[model samples]
Target chain A: MKTIQKQAQALLCNSLLASAVAVIFATSALADELNYSNKLLLTGGVSQVEGAAGGGLTPWAVIGGYGTNNEVGGSVHYTYVKTGDYKLDTYGFTIGLFDRVEFSVAEQSFDLGKLRNKVTAGLGADVFGRNQLTQTIVGLKVRVAGEAILDADTWMPQIAVGLQYKDNDETDFIKSAVIGAKSDHGTDVYVSATKLLLAQNLLLNGTLRLTKANQFGLLGFGGDKHDSYQPMLELSAAYLLRKDLAIGAEYRMKPDNLRSPANDLLFGGANVVDLKEDDAFDVFIAYAPTKNISLTAAYVNLGNIATVKAVGADYGNQEGVYLSAQIGF
Target chain B: MNINIKAATAALLATATFLMAQPAIAEVYAQNPNLGNTPMEGTATFEAFGGKEGLVKIMDDFMIGLVADPRTKPFFDNNKQTFIKAMLVEQMCELMNGGCKYPGRDMKASHANMKVNREGFNALVEQFQFAMDKHNVPFSAQNKLLAKLAPMYREIETTTGDAVPPVFPKAE
Candidate 1:
C-alpha cells in the first residue's frame, strides 16, 4: 500500500511538470505571428488588499503596463508563501493578448504546518509527508473597463473578470482514501476592481471572490458549501515610495465554516465531514525596482480552529512569510 | 567678467560647430571601406545619447534614489507582500537599454487622466536627474536621455490648465 501511494504521487508530480511545456505549446499554436511589447514589464499596483478605501482597479492596473504597448506578451513567474510550517509555492507562465485578455497556467504546492512526517508502515521516512498538496491550475482574466493610467479626478474604477480552474492531488495513503476523492477539480470566478488615486500619490485596490473549493483543503477535498456563499474583502493602499516604486499593505478576510453535518449518516444522506476555518489576516510588502519586474513579500496569520483541536490533529497553525517574483514580456 | 562672458560665447559656438561635424563623421564612417560595415555606423547613436554605455548607471541610480526618496515615500513604505521592486528594477533597466518595446501603456494613456502638473513633473524629473548625477552620467548623455524622454510629457503633463517640465527655471 505504501509503495502504491508513492507511485501514485510520482505520477501526479510528473504530469504537473509536463504542463509547463504544454502551456508554451498552446500559446505558440494560438498566435504564431505577433510581436508584443519587448518593453519593461510592470508589477502589481498600490492596493495591497482587496477593497480599496479610496479607489478600485484602473485600466493601467489591469494589464500591468502591457495594455499601453498595443501588443500581446507572456511571462514566467514564481511565488512562495510561507507561514511557520505552512508554505504555498506557485510557478507559472502568464500570457497577455493585446492587453485585452490574459491566460495563465500555474502549479501550486502547499505544505501544511510543515509538520513532521513519520512513515510507520515500516517504510522508513522520506521527505514525503509534511502533508504537501499540489494543484494544477489554469486561469483566464479579461479586462472589462476604464482608461487612463492615473485618474486625478474621482475614482474611475477599472474592473476585470477572471476564472481559475484548479485540480488537486494529495500524498498520504490513508488521507487520500478517506478523502473519497483522491483527485478533485474546482472552478473559481472572481471580479477585481482597482484605481490609481494620483492626488496623494496613492493607489487603492480591492477584489471580490466567490468559490467552492472548500478553502484550498487536503487532496482537493472541499466541503459542500451547499451552494452557500462566502465573501472575502481585501483593502490595500500603495503610496509611491518613489517615482518608480511603491510599497503597500493589505488586510483580508476568509470564510468561517469548519465542521461536520451532525447525523447525516443516520439521516441516510451522502455523508462527508466538513472541515473549514474562520477568517484570517494576511499583510504583505511589495517592491518594484523597475516597471518590468516586481518582488513581493508578505506574512500570513491564520487563526486557530477551536473545534478541530478537539478532534485529533493539532494544526498549531501560526504565521508564515513569503516572497514572490513576477515578470512581464 | 565681460571677458569671461565673451569667452563662454565663443566656446558655445565652437561646441555647436563640433556637434554639427559629428553627424558628418557618422555618415563618412558608414561609407568607410576600412572598417567592416555596421548598419549602426550609418546613423548617430551618439546624437541621441552620449554613446552606447550612457543610460545604464543613470537609469540604475535614478531608481536607487527613487527607492530612497521621501517625496515618493508613501508608495512602498509599508509594503510586506508586494513585489513592485523587482518589477521596476527590470523595467527601468530595460528602458535605459536601447529600443526595448516597453510593454507598459503610453505615458499619456497611463498618466493622462492623472493630471500631473509642472511641479509634480519637475519633482519627478529632479529625482531622475539626481539619480543620473549620482551614477556619474555625463552631461551630454543626460541631455540626450532627456531629449528622448521629453516627448513622453504629452502623456503625463498638462500645458493650458496644467504645467510643463521646468517648474521654475531660475530668473537670469
Candidate 2:
C-alpha cells in the first residue's frame, strides 16, 4: 500500500511537469508580443470617471481615488458649485485598495452671501456666516459572490458588497442648542453593487445606506437624537457614448435633521430643483482625455430648503452646476 | 496561320511560373488537423508554408522589430546584437518551415543568463508587432510563425525564476 501511494505521488508530479512543458512548447509555436495585449492581451491603464456630483458619491471625489482592473483605485478631487448666491467649495477623496475594499474623506465650506440677504436677516451676517464641514469614511467591500472580470465575449456582470464608516464635522448651528445631540460624529453603513453589462458600453450601479447622521452636513444638526435608522439611496446609470467618453445621471437621497427652530423632519433628507423634496438629481459627463486622466462636469437641481416651508413652503428655487477634474497614473 | 511549337512551349512555361508565384491556399480548420496543434515543424509544414525564402522573410521582419522596439531598446542595447539576432533567426526559421534544422541552444539554456521576467518578455513581443505592422504582414502568416515560438516560455520562465502564467503577463 505504501509503494502504491508513492507511485501515485510521483505520477501527479510528472503530470504537472508535462503540462508545464506542453504550455511552454505551445507558446513557443504561437506568436505573442510585449504590449499589455501583446503579452497576455488583457486591458490595463485605468482612468477616472469624470462626471457630476451626487450627494451619495461626491465626497469620494475630494481625495484621489479610482477603479482598478476589476480591482480598486482612488482619486483626489476639487469641486466648485453655485446655488443662487451660495458658492460651495468642496474637497473630496476616495480610495478602493482592491475591488473589494473602499475608503473616502471629504470637506465642504459654504460661503453664504452678504448680511442683507432676506434669508439671514434674523441671524445677521455675524451669526450666520460661512462655515466648513468635513466628512471622512473608512469602508470594507467584499464580493461575497461575484466576478470582477468579464468573461470573454459575454455579459455576465460582476457584483460586490461594501460597508462604509463615515465621520462628519459639526457646526455651531447644532452646538448652539438648536438640536439636542451629544456629538456630531456618526457612522453610515452602505451596501453597494455594480455591473458593466456591455464591454465598457453601459454600467448600472446603486447603493443603499442605513445611517444615524443627519443631513449631508449642510445644516447644524448631526445624527438622529435616538439613533434613528435613517435611509439613503443612490441610483446611477452610465453609458459609454464613445470609446473613452461616458455620460450618466444619478438620483441621490439624504437625511433631514436640521432642528434649529424645529419644524417637522428638520434635516430635509434631500434637495432638488429648489422644489423642497427629499432627493436630488445630477447629470454629468466624463471625458477620458487619456488612459490616465479624466475631466467631469455636471448640473444639479437641489430643491428648496424645507425649513422655509414653515414660513409658507414657497421659497423659490435654487439651481447649481458642479465641475471636477480627475487624474490617475 | 501556322502552328508554332516553340510559342506553345513558351506559353506553358509562363503559366507554370505564375502558378509557382501564387501564395498558399487558406486551409479549412476542421479538415487541416493542424488547428489547436502545438506549433511543431514537419516535412509537410514546410511545403504548406512557403519554401525556405518565405519563412526566412517572416523571421527577418520579426528580428528587425525585436531590435527596433523602444520598449525592448534595452534588450539590444544591453546584449551583443549579432549573436542574439543570428540565433533568433535560426531557431524561428527551422522551427517553422522545417526546411532547415534547428541547431540553437534550448529555451532555458539560451535565456538562462538573462534574468528575463514577464515584463521583459512583453517588451520584446511589442517590438515584434510593431515590426510586423511596418512590414504589412498578414495575420495568417503571423499566426503560422507564432506557433513555433510559443513553447519556449516554460523552460525559459523556469530558468529565470519568473512567474509562470498561462499566457503573457501584461495586466498583472
Q: In CAPRI terms, where does candidate 2 land? A: incorrect
Q: Write the per-residue lDDT of candidate 1 for residues A238-321, one digit (tens) a residue.
A: 655444455565544444433344315322343222344544555555665644456666666654422123223345555667
Query: Tens-digit lDDT track for model 2 on A166-273?
Result: 444443444543343435455555544444443234555555555555444444324333335555656667665643567788776665543343323344542211
Query: Lowest lDDT 10-mer window, candidate 2 chain A?
Result: A42-51
Best by TM-score: 1
Residue-by-residue lDDT tens digits, candidate 1, B1-172:
0013344345445433432332112223232222211223222333344333444444445555554654333322334212333433333333344333234443455444345543344445556767665655554444334433433444566542333222222223
Candidate 1 lDDT for residue A264: 53
Model 2 residue B94 CA deviation in Å: 30
The weakest ten consecutive residues by lDDT in model 1 chain A span: A50-59
DockQ of each model against the real complex? 0.02, 0.02
lDDT per residue (tens digit) for residues B1-172 in model 2: 1123354345445433432443222323232222211234454544444556544565566666654664354445433555555665555555554544455665666655555554446456545644555555543444345433433343454423333323222222
Q: What do the candidate models score in CA lDDT, each in turn?
A: 0.45, 0.44
Q: Estimate each model's TM-score.
A: 0.52, 0.50
